[model samples]
Target: MQHIGIAKLGKRTKSLVKRLKAGDIAIIDHVDLDRVTAESLIDAGVEVVINASSFISGRYPNIGPLLMASEGIYLIDAVEEDVFNQIKEGDEIVVRGDKIFHKGKVLASGKTLTVPIIKEKMEEAKKNIGAELEKFATNTLYYMQKEKDLLLEGMKVPESSVNFNGRHTLIVVRGHHYKADLKILRSYIKEVRPILIGVDGGADALLQEGYKPDIIVGDMDSVSDEALNSGAELIVHAYKDGSAPGLERLKKMNLPSKLFNALGTSEDIAMILAYEKGADLIVAVGTHANLVEFLDKGRAGMASTFLVRLKIGEKLVDAKGVSKLYQSRAKISHLIILVFAAFTTTITIIMSSTTIRGILRLIILKIRLYWGF
Candidate 1:
C-alpha cells in the first residue's frame, strides 16, 4: 500500500532487482506488457506493479498483469502522475476505483485517467525498426555472397569424405531477446530434439542455458573458447577457397574441427548440413525468420534461409518471437520429490524384505572375507 512517484518506477525498470533488494516498491512506466519485460520484473521480485502505458490493459494476457497476479503482486493501471505525486514512498496506498488511500488517509480522489493516443508513437517505433532491419539484411546478404564465393572455390580441393542424408538440422542465431525466445521453444525442443546446432555467438547462448549443442558451426568469431570446447562437434564455416580464418583459433585451443567450405553464413551452412544429413525436423531458436529479423542482420537477401526453409518445408519451425506469445518457468520441486520418494521406497523395500536382508548379509560377509576383515 505504499505510494511512490512515477519517476522512481522509471529508474527501477533499469535495475529492478537492485531497487527491490533495497526495499523499494516499483512502479513500471510505459511497459508494452511484453513477455520479456514481464518475466524480468517478476524475477526481480517486485511487490507491486503500476503500469503507465499498457496497450491491452485487461483484454489480453499481457506480461505485466499475468506476472503480477502469478507472483501475488498488487497491480494498478492507468494512473496519472498527479496521483503519483500525492503519494510518497513507503506510504500504504490502496486503490478502489480512481481513489487512492494511503494508510487510511485519502491522498487523491479522481476518475480513472485516459492515456494519450499512442498509435502514432507505436507506428514511429515500428518504422524505425523496419529501417534498421533493412540495413541489417543488406549487410548480411553481402557477407553471405562473399562467404559463398569462397566456399565455391574450396569445393575444387580434395577434402575428407562427409556424410549427407538430408536431415532437418537447426542452426541458432542469437539476437535481441533470444533468451526469452529459447524459453518459449522449450516444449518444441523436448518434442523435436533436432540435431541442435549453434552458429558463432549462438553457441554461447546455448551454453548460457546449460544446453550442450550437438555441433558448433560458425566462422569462429564472437564465440567463446568454452563453447568451442563444450564437447560438441565443431564445423568451421570457411570460404570456397578452403581457407578458414577461424581454423587457426581452434588450433590455438588445441581443438579439432571439420571445415565446411560453404558460401553462406554459418547458420546457412548448418541448415544445409542438417538437410543433407536427412534430419526429420528443424526447429530454429533465436534465428531470423521474418523480413525485419533478417534485415536487422544487415543482409541483402535471406537467400540461404529462404532456400533452406523451402527445402525443409513443413519440417521447419521458426521460433523467433515465440517467447513473446508464451511464458513458462519450469519448477523442479515435483521432480525432486519424486526422486527422494523413489530412493526412500527402495531403501524401505530392501530393509523390510527377508530375501533382501539375506542378500545384503551375504554380500557384506563376502566383502569382509575378501578383505580378511
Candidate 2:
C-alpha cells in the first residue's frame, strides 16, 4: 500500500505532536513509544508515522505500536536516524510499504509494524518483564538508600502565593487517562474550587479542558506559551543543585516564576509542595503510579515516586482510574426511568388521594354544566 503526506519531524514525540496536522506524516525518533505518545499522535490525526527507532524493542510490552496498529495508522518503524537530516519539514514523503521516499528518491527503509508483529513483540517483552522488574527494583533500592532523606525530611518547601492550606489542591500530570479523568472531575472542580496545579504539559491539558490553572509547575519544557501566559503563578522544577533549565524559557518569555529546587519528578515536587504548604487534601490526576507507567516515562525506577507518596501518605487521592470506579453521570436510560417513575408517582397520587379526586370530579362537573352536556 502507498501513502503520501507532508513530513513533520521531531526527535521528541511530545514536541513533534504539537505541530502535527491531520494527514501529515509524523517523523519521530521515539523508541519503544509509550501509550501516551501514541494517543497524542492519534489525536493529531496523522495518517502515517515514520519512527527513527524501534517501535517496540522488547521493552516490557510497551503498547504504543499496538495501539497505532489497532487504529489503522501506518507505522514505519526503525528507520535510519539520518532521515531527520535528509528530509525537511513539509517535504512531501511517500510510504510505499516499509520504505520512505522523498521526491521519488528512496530516503530510508524500515519495518512495517503490524498488529501481529506488535503482539508477538509484546508477548516477548512480557516474558522479559521479570528481568526488567529486577533491574527496576535494584535501582529503586539504590536510590532509596541515597535519597532516603526525601522521606525522612522533605526539602525546604517554597512559599506560594496561592494558598493550599486546608483547601483541596488538584495536581494534574499528563499521564494516562488524564483527559478523561479531568472531564470526570468537572463538577468537583466547579463545586470545591480547588487550587488547580498543572505540571508541565499538564498545564496545556488544563487549558484544553477550559480550566485556568491557579499554578503551573514543572520543567516548563512541554508546556505551551499560551498556558504560561494564562496568568497562573509559575514554579520551575529544579535540580537539587538549583540548576533550573526551565527558568531560562520563562526568562525569555518574560514570565515571572519561582524556583523549587529538589530531586524527583515534577509531579512529585508538586505534591510535596502542596503537602508542605499544609494542604488538607491533595487530589492527583494523571500522575504515574504503576511500574509500567514509570517505565514508560523512562525512569529507571519509581524510587522518587515511592518516597514522595510515602511522605504524602493518605492525603493524596489518586484519580487515575476514578473514571472506572463509578459512572460520572446517570445514563440516559436511567434518566428516562427516573422521569417515568416521577410521572407515574404523580398520576398515582392524583388517583389515590380522596381530596384530589373530589377536586378533579368537581372541575369536570362544572365544565360539563357550562357546556350543557
Candidate 3:
C-alpha cells in the first residue's frame, strides 16, 4: 500500500506517535531496533514502515532486519530515493525485500516495512506480559507511597516558617512529561511570567534551561547545589509541625532557606506561597494536571493541588500542553532583517580580510575563465 512519507524518526518519534492515528503507514527514515523507542513505536500499531537507515553501518548490532524477519514483516536495505518517489499515500503495494511487488509488477524497491509489524508483535507481547507489568507497577506505587510518608514525617518541625496567603502560585513536579512540558512553557516565559517555582528535581530542570527560579520548594533530594545557589528563595516543604529534613542538605551546602511546614506536595506549598505573596496570576507549566500523570508518580490524591487551585480560582491557568497548542512562527520582517544582517556581516567580514579578498578574487577569476564572464 502507498504510505505517507513522514520519515525522520529520532527523538521526535514519541510526539509523532501520539499524533498519529491507527492504520496510517509511517515511512520512518531510520530505525534503531534495539532501543526502547523502537518497542514503543511497535506498540503504537504503525501499519507500514520503511527503514532508510543503514542496518550494519557500524559495529553496533543492527536489530531492525532481525526484528522484521522474526515478526514476518517485509524489509529492504540500501535502496535508492526512486522507490520512495513512486509511492503515494493510498496505493496498494506488496512489500517484499527491496522490490515492492505490486499488481504483478515491480513498483518500487526499498527497505523493509518493520514499524507496523513490530507494533503488532509488541501488542502481542504486552498482552502476554500484562500481568507482570501490572504487578511491577503496583509494587512501584507502594514504594513511592512509603517514601512519600517518610518524607512527610521528616518535613514536620516546630520552627518559624513561611506562611501562605491565598494567592496564585504554580509548583512544578518532576515526572516523565516534565521536560516536554517545561520546553513548552519556556517559550511563554515572557508572556505568562508567573512567579516561577520548582519542586526539587523540577528546580534542576529550571536551572538547566538557564532560568533562575523565583523560589525552590521541595524535599531537596534531587535538586542540585547549583540549582540551590541560583539566586531563588528556598522554601523547604515540611510537615504540619514544621520539621524538615531537606534543611540538612541546605545546611551542608551552606545555603539558608525558610521552612514551610505544611501538608501535601511541595508544589502545593509553592502555590500557597504565591497566594500568600499576593501573586495575581499563577500559570503552571510541566506541573501534573491529570490523574494519570499524578498516579504514575504514585500520588494517591491531588488534594493539595485541588485546594490550591481552588483558592487561586479564576487567576490560575494550567499550561500543561500549551506548547503543543501554538508554535512560534517567524515573521516576514524578522526573517528579512535577519537575512539582511547576516549578509551585511558577511560583507563586512569579507571586506575586512585580505586573505578572504584574495580567495574571492581567485574564485571569481576561475569562474570568469570557465564561463567567459
Every model: Cα RMSD to truth? 12.8, 3.5, 16.9
Which candidate tops lDDT? Answer: 2
Model 2: weakest 10-residue lDDT segment is 145-154
Each prediction's whole-model lDDT (CA): 0.61, 0.91, 0.59
Q: What is candidate 2's lDDT per residue for 1-373, written digit by digit as tens?
A: 9999999999978889999999999999988899999999999999999999998888699988889889999998889799898899989989999988888899899999889988998998999899999999999999887777779975897778887879999999999999989999999999999999999999999999999999999999899999999999999998988799999999999999999888789999999989999999999999999988888999997778899999989999999988888775778999999999999999999999999999999999999999999
Instruction: Write down the lDDT that model 3 would get.
Output: 0.59
lDDT of 1 by residue, 163-210 (tens): 334544556776546787876666656775656688887887788776
The order by descending lDDT is: 2, 1, 3
Instruction: Mark the regions of model 3 whose C-alpha exceeds 4 Å error after superposition.
Output: 1-171, 191-193, 329-373
Error of 1 at 264 (Å): 2.2
Please write out the lDDT profile of model 3 over residues 1-373, one tens digit for every residue: 3443233232234344544444544444453343323444555555555555543333223344455445543445445445556555455555544565545687656545355544554455445444544554575455545445323333333232333334345557564345667786764675655566888867877777777777788888667678888877888887767688899989988888888777777776666566556677776666666543553344555656655566667766776666577767999999999999999999999999999999999999999999997
Once all C-alphas are superposed, what RMSD does model 1 give against the true structure?
Answer: 12.8
The segments of candidate 1 whose C-alpha lies over 4 angstroms from its true place after superposition are 1-170, 187-192, 328-373
TM-score of each model, paired residue for residue? 0.47, 0.91, 0.47
- Tell me how far the alpha carbon of residue 144 in candidate 2 is from the true structure, in angstroms, after superposition: 1.0
